[model samples]
Target: MTPELLLLSADRVGVLVFALSGGIAAVRNDMDLFGVIVLAFLPAVGGGTLRDLILDAPVFWLEDTVSLWLALLGGLLAFFFTRFLEDFKPLRWADAVGLALFAVTGAAKAWGMGHGFIIIAIMGVMTASAGGLIRDVVANRDPLLLKEDIYATAALAGAAVYAGLVYAGLDERIAFGLGMLAAFILRALAIVFKLSLPRARP
Candidate 1:
């Protein structure tokens, strides 16, 4: 496969994983199927959609319907395979992978749009966190942005790492790989070790 196609595939995989997470959250909250689907769609596409809108770029999923269908398929798979996954709990891993992939894609897209490094970092955070924000809102839970979790911080860290690599004249492929790896590794560590950023006292 072409390098561009491979990158696109990675991004799509992230979308699927995040979409499944949304659907799983819905099921755990006892939401109906429609609610589940909506949650899945939002978490999968929300960040990308927001980034595209902000950039005044064509919506990413509008040009290709594969993303939408993938989100649907992910939700369905999560719904039907819930019992099996419940035994081992795959959502954490899925979420880590998705966050890493989406953060890289988001920053790349922003850079492509001629945004500066800081703006690209913001886009990366938006792209990675939008889905979870939408899911939490739909499920009537406070989004991580409103809480103490290190969610967006993780995304920002990944984006900053990518920008640093690029600034250092690293190849795009290597930069993307390292940045994505950083996000996944950091997030997985956080989940596994219960590492969280400090919360400020009021």
Candidate 2:
């Protein structure tokens, strides 16, 4: 596949997964359908929207309605099927997948658009994470940004790997795959091992 199509596919997968996680978080917060859907959309699209706006690219969701509908479906599924998922032990693992995919996709897109490595890395973190931050605030929980959650760090570490590989002239797919794997593995470890960054003093 062409790099553009590859990046688009990766971004779509990340968005869908993040939307599902957002919907799950909404259910956990006792939000209704509307709330869940909103949360899902915000998490799924917010990062890319922000990135596109900053880069003067067409806002992605405005150009494609599929992402919107998918987010809606994810939210609805979470709302209706939360009980089925409540007892599942792999929820954290699923979230890690979303995080890793989003980070790699964001970095790949930025690099494809001719952004510098630093900007690409920042965009990677943003694409992977800004949605969940919005969800937490909207749900009246302390945002992960305010806590020692393994959230942004997971994205940053993944982004660094992506940037480094790109700088090293690796094949695009190999780089992207490795970057995504790194992020996912780190995030899963963080969840399973209770890994977290140390808190800062005010």
Candidate 3:
């Protein structure tokens, strides 16, 4: 597939993964079907919407309806099949995948739009974390970004790495792969080892 098509494919996968994570959270909280759908939809598109607004670009979901439909389908499937995922802890896994994918895709989009390195990095982190932030807030849980875990940090590192690689004349596809790998590995390690940054004592 063409580069643009590859990126779009990755973006869709991220949306579906994030939507499943959000749906799982809603179901765990005993949310109704509509509530589950709403939560699923929010995280699926929240980060991209915010990033687009910040960049003065069109909201992505408005530009393509597939994202919306996938999110809804994810929620509906999760709601009906929560029992099958009881032991899987789908939320954590899905979040990790979504975070990695979105971080790379967000950086790629910003770079394609001619943004500078710093802006691209910021957009990448925003795209990776904003949806989870909204999800946690709406679910009345502590936002992951505020936690000590290496969540947003992973995204920041990945984005910066991706941007630097691209600037250093690496192939875009290679850069994208490395960026996603970096984010996913960091997140996976954090999850596996219960890793966290040092906290303030105030």
Candidate 4:
């Protein structure tokens, strides 16, 4: 597949997972139906919206209504299926998956735009975290970006890896796979082992 087609397909997958994560968060927080919908919608599109705006590209959901429908579908699924997911840490795992996917897509978009490595990586982190940040704030939870949770760090690493691979002229699929694996594994390790970065002392 062409790089554009690859990114487009992967990007929608990221959207669905992110929306699912948001919906799960809302259900966990005991939100009402409308609240749940709002939560699901925002995180699904927030980061991508920001990235597209910054890049002067068309806003994704605006250009593609399928993304919006996916958000709604995710919210409905969470509303109906929270009980089934209770045993699993749905929020964290879904978030991790979303984080990895978005990081790759974001960095890829910046790279496609011919941005330098730093900008590419920065966009990746922004795309990976902004929606979750919005979710956290609205849900009255701590923002992962502000915590020593290693969340944004994982995204940064993933973005860096993808960008580096592309620059090295590796195949796009390989670059995406390695980059996503880097982010998801790091986040999974943090989730499983309670790993964290150093916190500042008062």
Candidate 5:
């Protein structure tokens, strides 16, 4: 894919999953439609918004309305099909996908802007986790992003992989995909087996 298309694809997917996660959180909290929409919008764009502000770049959703629409779609899906989504218990998995995609995309964005590897990784983590932080805070729940679930570790691993691969002369598309996959797998395993970096407390 073209560079622009790749970035768009990753960003849009990230936003959707994050929105789904937020929607599920709202549903679990017994929130109404308005609250569900509000929750959906938070994690869907919070990380990117923070990234842009820190980078002094144009905020993404302001640059494109499709993201807002996608978030709305996610909210509507969760609202109308709460039972179906709940059957899958998608909050953790949605967050996992969102985290991975955002991390890779954020790393790519920073790299495109001439940042060094460290900043790219940090930006990736910020973009991956900021929205989740907002989601947990607004829902009055323990911030999973701050917990020992290997959440940020997975994001950091993805960003690092993307940055390393690009620097190693791999195609950006391949790098992006592999990076996202690495994160998703790590987080998914953690979710399934109660794993954590530095090892989980027994």
Candidate 6:
């Protein structure tokens, strides 16, 4: 597939997964249908919205309404089937997958826009973590950004790897896949082992 098509696919996957994560969060918080939908929509597009705003680009969901529909669908499905997912914790893994995909796609978008490495990395991290941060805050929980785990760090590492590989003349698709894999593995290991960064000494 073309680079644009590949990125688009990644974006959709990230949106859907994050939307489900958000929906789960809303259900856990005892939110109503409207609240669930709102929460789902937030994480589904929040990061990309922030990135586009920062980049002075058109908002992605506005450009193509598929994202909005997907978010609503995910929310509604989760709302109606919360009982089915009670034993399955979907949030952590879904968030990790979304973060990995979004981070790589965000970096690719920044590179395509001719941004510098620093800006690309920043955008990638923002795209990966911003939505979850917003979701957590709205759910009255600690944002993952403030957590001790290697959340944003994983995104940054993946984005850096992708940017470096592309700069070094690797195929964009290959770079993106490798970057996503790296981020997913790191985040998954952190989750499996309950790992976190060292706390600052008071």
RMSD of 4: 2.9
**What value does the lDDT take at residue 160 in candidate 2?**
87
Off by over 4 Å in 2: 1-13
Listed per model in order, the count of residue pairs whose N, CA or C atoms clash below 3 Å is 1, 0, 0, 0, 0, 0
lDDT of 3 by residue, 1-202 (tens): 9967776776777788788878888998899999999989878989988999988888888869999999998899779887775567655766787788898878888999999999999999999988878998998877767877889888987898899999999999999989988998998999999888888889
* Pairs in steric clash, model 3: none
Pairs in clash, predicted candidate 6: none
State residue 8's C-alpha deviation in candidate 6, in Å.
5.4
Query: How well is each residue in 98-147 modelled by candidate 2, as lDDT tens digits?
Result: 78888887888899999888999999998888877888888888887658
Candidate 4 stretches greater than 4 Å from native = 1-13, 89-94
Error of 1 at 94 (Å): 2.6
Best candidate, TM-score:
1
* Candidate 5 all-Cα RMSD: 3.0
TM-score of 3: 0.88
* Cα lDDT of model 4 by residue, 1-202, tens digit: 9867765766676677777778888998999998888898888888888999999999977878998998898788778886875565665676687789898889989998999999999899989888889998999987766886788889998999999999999998899889998999999998899889998888
Model 5 per-residue lDDT tens digits across residues 46-101: 88899999888999889789999999998888888877877777556766877898
User: Cα lDDT of model 1 overall?
Assistant: 0.83
**How accurate locally, in lDDT, is each candidate?**
0.83, 0.82, 0.86, 0.86, 0.87, 0.86
My TM-score estimates for the predictions, one after another, are 0.90, 0.87, 0.88, 0.85, 0.85, 0.89
The number of clashing residue pairs in model 1 is 1
Worst 10 residues of 4 by lDDT: 85-94
